[model samples]
Target: MQAPELVERMLRGDRRAVARTISLVENAAPQLREIMAGLAPHTGRARIVGLTGSPGVGKSTSTNALVKALRARDESVAVLAVDPSSPFSGGALLGDRVRMQEHATDGGVFIRSMASRGHLGGLSWATPHALRVLDAAGFGVILVETVGVGQAEVDIARHADTTVVLCAPGMGDSVQAAKAGVLEIADIFVVNKADREGARVTARELRQMVGQVEHGPGEWKPPIVSTVAAKGEGIDELLGRLDEHHAHLTATGEADRRRFARAREEIEAIVMSTLRARLGDVHGHAALDKLADAVATGHGDPYSAADTLLAALDT
Candidate 1:
């Protein structure tokens, strides 16, 4: 279908159109500009939530449980499960469709697995665009589940309105979270596998850590909720906390600020990507190569090389 038709279908909540549009985004198809333009006016309606944590933390299971809760509330949800990339084909290593089979047939739920494509941040570069498509497709809530992230891979905070960090008991994840600076990025900390032996200790550690942060009067403090996600335990409390955080964001005007920042970053990323593409052009590439050769031989400096490349790109 044409971009206009696709956008219309997507806005009308057509699942096929939503999938096709996201595919276009993932592949960086030429139709994106027109499609994004058409979809832009319909976005900003969905509530975006991001889930990230270490491996074996039940992130997927927690996400599955969350989807069930949201569906019970009669809300439509889209799950963007980002998986590690396959080295050979750059495809998503894990198929979320298999893990989330219960929701596969639910019209109110749309689940897609996207490869991170070697992005060190644990999220695909196309994530923002894919989110826009889902939001415009009329999903009430969008869940972004990142690949198992390590220290410095907490980019999910930049993309979502609410960020949930999950940790399982007995994994030393609580300490790892502190060391990784994830403590600062998390709006909600979950101790999944709460039925495990060390679950209470893990939750206590997170609470103590959170309490150490000095928040002024109305500042939101991250809460530690324990859950056995595999059995859908404590999911209700998790949902309640999500609601409370959303309300806090609205009451404090932080929601608008976050959305503005998200938009600014999205625009900047697009510009950077476009510039990189331009710099890969024939003239720009040749100019850069010549500069590199000169710099290597000590005939040209690195600064001058960059200047020449910029000039070539401008031309």
Candidate 2:
């Protein structure tokens, strides 16, 4: 398909266009560069909110409820649910959207499931590219949910205007926020399933963790909100806190600084990837193949051979 037609369809809010654009970005197809370049100006209008937490915290349920609420207010919403597939198999179990009841044909809301494609932090590297597409496509709100919790999913902080960390009671509640590096980035902390017992204790633990962190520039403290996502309880308060954090970011220019930094990092990675692609063409893969065989056989040191090959690539 021609690029212009595809872009036009995207502007029309065509679902196929959304999928196609994301695929183009994910594959890093050089041909889509021109299309994305034109689409860049349409981005930045959407407010991105990232929701994340450990397993079984009703994050998906909460996300669906929130999207439904916004849609009720006549807002256009887009949900990018990023899930990681098992490395052994090459498919995703991105089933979070299934719990989102009654919004399939709502027209005001768009929900698309995404696999991480093995990117670090359980987010595909092309995710920012997809975000740009959605931003340009004019979705008023975009929510990014990531909960792959071993290493502090800090990438969400880089992408979202406000980061929300969700927690629940009846578990190792005290360390929930602290252990995931979430205590640092969360602008708003939510103790979901708040109707359950131990809700107050969980909230207290999160508050203590937040208190220990050195107040960042502008020194606005993080607020903890309790919610029962299943029944839509406290969602308004959650949304209000989200807005407050966004206002703080805007008032202090922290938002712009973070966006600029994220753009720089993404652009640098793209440039290096392009350079590496150019390297293979210049070095000739067949010759490099023989060099690889030689190195494996102990006939040549991998470093010197790689240096020689890379030097040729510069030319």
Candidate 3:
């Protein structure tokens, strides 16, 4: 079907159109550039918050809790939970949809699971397209949740208007948070299971870490919140903070700056993905396969392989 036709249907709030648009974006359709241009005008208006943590730190649970709280405030929320890409099949794990069962019947809440699909470091090339559909469809809040693995945690803050990093007791992630790159990206630190034995200790370490950072005058201090997401404990307080942060951004003229950064990152993701698609297998299969073999054999330099891809651009 034509891009305009699909876009018109999506503007009319057709569920099928919305799903179809998202599918096209996910697959990086050749016509996607045309589709996005049409949808651009309908974008913005959704508060995109990124929730991220290690796989077991209850990122999804907290996300569900936040969505519920937002709905209670009469806000329509869209949750896009992200999963890792499959190495062999390149498909998303899609566990978030199955886990967010309670919101299945709620029309006000739209939930979707996305995958990096080997688009590393929180790569969300199709996110702008998806968010555009939701924004046009009338969602007031958009939550992008990522499984905080590797250096991808930093990427979340880049996408979100306000980022909340989730950490729980017994995760041995205190220093790891400082090193995992989560600490730098978080505007707020959450000790997810406040009732746990070492919640306070975890909070203290985080607080100290935050204190050590030198900031310009009037910098917003990141607050450490404690919550038990399963029973909805502390959910209200967390939502309150989200509201406060959003308000601060708008009041201080920082919203424009934050949106600028988010836009750039989103555009970079799209451009990079599109370029990669246009040039399939950037590193020839043989070179990449051999590079993997070389790493295994400790004979070939991975850096040379990277240099090779750049050099190929000149060829």
TM-score, candidate number 1? 0.91
Specify the highest-TM-score model's number.
Answer: 1
Candidate 2 clash pair list = none
Model 3 spans with C-alpha error above 4 angstroms: 85-94, 120-124, 273-315
TM-score of 2: 0.87
Q: For model 1, which pairs clash?
A: none
- Best-to-worst ranking by TM-score: 1, 2, 3
What is the Cα-based lDDT of residue 141 in candidate 1?
94
lDDT tens readout by residue for model 3, 240-294: 8888888888888887898787788778877776666544556557766766787
lDDT tens digits, residue span 241-288, model 2: 877888888999987887787788778767776666687778768878
* All candidates: TM-score: 0.91, 0.87, 0.83
Candidate achieving the largest lDDT: 1
| Local distance difference test values of all predictions, in order | 0.84, 0.77, 0.76
Which residue runs of candidate 2 sit more than 4 Å off their true CA positions?
Answer: 84-101, 118-124, 173-177, 283-306
- How many pairs in model 1 have backbone atoms within 3 A of each other, for residues 3 or more apart or on separate chains, i.e. clashes? 0
| Model 2 local distance difference test score | 0.77
lDDT of 2 at 98: 56
Our model 3 lands, by Cα RMSD against the true structure, at: 3.6
